[model samples]
Target: MNKIKLVLALVIFISFTALKTKDDDFVKRSFDAATPLYTSLLNLTGDNFKNYPHSFLPNGTVKYYQIDEWTGGFWPGSLWYIYEFTREEKWKIAALKWTNSLESNQFNDKHHDIGFMMYCSYGNALRFDNNPKYQQILVQSAKTLTKRYSPIVGSIQSWNQRKSKGDINTWEYPVIMDNMMNLELLFYASKVTKDDTYKNIAIKHAEQTMKNHLRTDYGSYHVINYDPKTGKVLHKQTLQGFSDESNWARGQAWGIYGFTTTYRETKDKRFLKTAVKMADFFLDHPNLPADGIPYWDFNVGQAGYKPDWNFDPNRFKTTPRDASAAAIASSAMLELSTFLNGKQKEKYYNAAVKMLKSLSTDQYLNTDKANPYFLLKHSTGNLPSGREIDVPLIYADYYFLEGLLRYQKLKK
Candidate 1:
């Protein structure tokens, strides 16, 4: 019995030492990889308002600007997040310049992604700066967001000019799963302005997402149709991924993070429950690779379809999985882990650490200085023309930094 006890003690010590060694090695590698990225990011920020276009380019040349794309939020948001982490004055300068360029969009009479486009940039800037002028910008942006609330739908319309597309009017006020995330701005506006309308709007939107976007098993679809006239859910589908019923990896990530954020703001049992469901779906999905990274589409393994035979030459036929999803999930898991206790927290923290460690070593972390960008080999804007196919993407880098910061904060 003494011999057996001694053997068990030895095994436990070995396991503990191995775990500690792995964690220490990961911290060293992550810090080393981020150093050059941190320096280059500083230089990029120092170039000031004149050099950067509306958004940052991977190669540091911003000759072209994509004004209407969803990616517009990432640059300034990234700058703001980076500044918060690094406390570098140069990052603030770059972010302020980007924020200053969005005066018209904040007050635009239209209502499509004002939360995503304006709040993430200007609102975050206000959070970082605490300047009255930035506060005013955020307030106006919030009012604009409040105006988007539709009485018919009890939720904000996700896009505009949907009916003007003639026969394509079948898409009725589509409230995507992605929109669940945008509700954060509305919830914040409620806190800032002491207004119940903003809070109500955010909760109503989340309830709608729960009713429409989520499946019985908690897997969520990307897009859902709402009756613009009656506010009823018409259908739910995966617009960007394999099919209407198939899971999109990133969409699941959005649901995981979005629902968790909703829980954070509301402390509502429903939101927390939904978050757990989504978390379980994400971690238990067999489609994910052993390394914790996921394919661009979760249904790719099951989808017996081919890309259009006349596919564009620029787009690769093969799917290069997205590193951004892993980054985003890692960050979200850290946040979600904090909200849980005991075994749940341990499981989530362990999963998050493993995913991040995998990302740190995978093709995602491009330490090559000639490239300049830290996180590479991402698949953003991969659909349609296949704009950014298996290349270094700015958002991937942004999320990687954000994830690292979140992980570091959790450790401390």
Candidate 2:
């Protein structure tokens, strides 16, 4: 009788497990269509964005043009991530070519984006091979970043004199919302080099952001005004969003990811709590489209009178389908979900699954059987240049792969 009871229990367990696996497999099938689309982008871009290069201007040029400033470097990093997943030599060769191109830009002290510079290039290379030079490059980049920290503000300024001609304009000081996403590189540098200074600076920058960058309701602004001398938060403004007062979709997404990362590093409940709050705000906002993707700006479809003119073909509106935001937010959701236990974890897990499904099936995904770039419709570099409106964006491809990898790992 004991043997029979044991056998019966085993059978029940196996049967129940199979049913859950079947259900999970069914849900994962939705990603099947998107997987190849991502793989195709890796193929077409050819490791270094060579095949579908950043387009040239009407003057017929072919230099390293970018869609936007904040994440243009992320393009190569994205390719590296795909290579990490696929382990294809083609991706590696492309990544090497792109990293080679970035050499001249490194240590130039032009921009405050060491994360984009080191994380994708040297960071990826170092991970694969214990190369001393890559470590040197990352250390040099970190030092350059450290120099940007203001004693007053305790944060690295985003724009530099290269843009302002040694003016030290207040507009250039203080961390932009996007800088939070890149701070991880510095934190990583600290761990690899066994240096506390890098970690300290990175944390200080985040603390400054918490005090100044985030708004009353936890909706963050894109830019903050700082007194360069005192490092004071003078004012906060929303440059690219609908209004200085209105919420920007991408900014919210950045908050969701950045704060969560900060919390992971420090284990500070405030950062974790802040991340959950922001994530909740993003998921709960009525402005979000039914499909889980968001408009470029929250005020795009407000209940007021229509705009005097519809979106101009020549001029891209500040508000439109921002697939990039959705992709980033999806990755953040996975991270946030994994950290939580029990019911909270399950809720975020389901939401992330939903977002990924939406992204897979959404009309914006350019799954044109013939088109090489899977993520064709993405908006980027929206403010400075009106180019690449709702078109294939390289970063979109990058984040989609990241989110997929996160989901795949969660299942295990």
Candidate 3:
């Protein structure tokens, strides 16, 4: 019996050691892959922080966007993640250069994405350096964000109205599921300033979103249009999904991530419950692929879920998988797991690990030697608009690195 027990212990020790090494290698590869890719991007962009790398064209070239674009912060946010992982001064220098370029946006209250633009960049900077200037900038951003909020709508307006050819407005007080993500800036401002005004606006926006934005199955609408004066919901539609009723994969990911952040900041059980429900809906959906990536929309091939705007029958034959959604959800799940215990925690943690593993594979990890500017591939952006149908997206890489770091910390 003693001899058998010794042999079993030796086997278990070897297995555990191998598993640890494998996990370590996986994380190392992610950072190794990112460092060169971002270095190439920096080389291409040439210290010009105003033009941010957004995505790739069909011809495999990099697409750049200006500071006013919604995706401007993700590039700097990715650099911040790389710095956090490696603690290299070079990465910090790059991150600061890109992040500081957005300082003037703190007063630009044109849209609701100020949180994404400022928080993702400056928020991560504050986490590492704890600089007082970053705090002040974030607070100013939160104040600017508040300008878009309507007391009647109880939510922030996502876009300004655009006049069509016939002089009809496109939308009235439109709020998107993506706006859920901006609440983090408000919550952080509240925490740093010891003021409840920012916190209260965030809570009210979340409450209104919960009531109006989510379907019975917890699938979120990409956009919710409300009457600016009456606060009554007028349209529950989508701008990017297969149809107004279908669950857009990235929108669901945003819901899960945002609600999880809300729960973390507020400890409100309502937000926690909503986050879990949204996560469960995404994970358990029938349309999600075996590798955990999702089709651009959950109802992509379904009979009634076809979009009227860009109805491409050929595209449905090979629907693009959105690695960005998986990355975002995996990162969110890791954080969500921390708030749970027992089997629930294990389930989410294991699911997130599986997602990270899937994303690390060569099929998704962007292994082309000829083009090394992007991290992950096969991300679908604005499918209905016929844009970036299947390509590498900056935000996909941002969240993938974030998921890797979160997983590393949880493992330790």
* Per-residue C-alpha lDDT of model 1 across residues 1-412, encoded as one tens digit per residue: 9999999999999998898777756645765665566457556555453332232345655323355555456667777876786677877887787777666666754655666667768877877777777666666767787776787787777766353212334777777777776788778778888887878888988887888788898887887778878888776656666556767777888888888889999999899889888888888888878888877766664646333223343455656687777777777888999999999998878888888888777466665553554444555444433355455555565666667777877876
Q: How far is candidate 3 from the true structure (C-alpha RMSD, Å)?
A: 2.2
lDDT of 2 by residue, 1-412 (tens): 9999999999999999998686465235434544475455446555453223442233433224442333445556665766676677866766666665565444646567667656656677665667787777777778777777886778888875223212333464646788887777788778779988988888888888888877777777887877787766666666556555667788888888888888888888888888888888788888777888888767654655132223343454445677778888888889998789998888777887777766666465555543444453555535323455455555665677678778878877
Clashing pairs in 2: 68-381, 152-231, 153-231, 376-391, 376-392
Given candidate 2, what's the lDDT at residue 33?
Answer: 47
lDDT of 3: 0.89
RMSD of 2: 5.0
Q: At residue 91, what lDDT does model 3 achieve? A: 93
lDDT of each: 0.70, 0.68, 0.89
Instruction: Please give each candidate's TM-score.
Output: 0.82, 0.80, 0.95
The list of candidate 1 runs beyond 4 A from truth reads 1-64, 109-111, 163-169, 303-318
Please state the error at residue 47 of candidate 3 in Å. 1.3
Clashes of each: 0, 5, 0
* Backbone steric clashes in candidate 1, count: 0
Q: Name the better of 2 and 3 by TM-score.
A: 3
Q: Which candidate is the best by TM-score?
A: 3
Q: Where in model 2 is the C-alpha error above 4 Å?
A: 1-72, 161-174, 301-319, 369-371, 374-376, 380-387
